[model samples]
Target: MAGLITCLSVPFLSYLGLRSLPAQETAPRTIVNLEVIVVDTESKALEALERLKKGEKFSTVAAQMSIDPNAGNGGYVGEAEVASLRPELRAAVESLQP
Candidate 1:
């Protein structure tokens, strides 16, 4: 009887252990390719936006007007984990059509 009880409890304990473990993420991690043009003032940012709307190449405007160090590289900020981005930036990225 003791051996029977031990056998039953072993399976029960294993089940409980499995239940206690965190759920694994089955989805693949998302990566985002990003570019940015940082400027000191809102007006400058607006100007950049207008240029973009007018069909000016982003790399060109970034090279000429961005104050960021990456301006030389056309404001290339590199790839990032979408989950690791700031909330506002994540929202903006998510809103894009592509």
Candidate 2:
């Protein structure tokens, strides 16, 4: 009975160790960059921004005005982490107060 108990405890301890181990979570299906086509031509960036200001869905405006040739498929330019744009566009995007 003692030997059997120890054997049972070994598996239980193994289970506990595994359960406590950090779980590796894959990122939620990454929004593919291809999905956010930013048509950002000098002519078009503002048009899309205007639509966003008017409360249009950003994705919709992206679809319509993203200047990237693939805009029809995935109009994304990944992201523009605040400090990265040209001072003017950065000012414009940051000023949106979104």
The Cα local distance difference test for each model comes to 0.83, 0.55
Query: How many pairs of residues collide in each model?
Result: 0, 8
Candidate 2: tens digits of C-alpha lDDT, residues 1-98? 35542211212246447434333443333122223446547567676777788998766776677666656554555644555556886566656632
Top model number, TM-score: 1
Q: What is candidate 1's CA lDDT for residue 88? A: 99
Global fold similarity of model 1 (TM-score): 0.70
- The numbered model that scores best in lDDT is 1
Model 1 root mean square deviation, Cα atoms: 11.1
Q: Write the per-residue lDDT of candidate 1 for residues 1-98, one digit (tens) a residue.
A: 35542211112247447434333433567898788899999999999999999999999999999999999999888999988999999999888887
lDDT of 2 at 63: 64
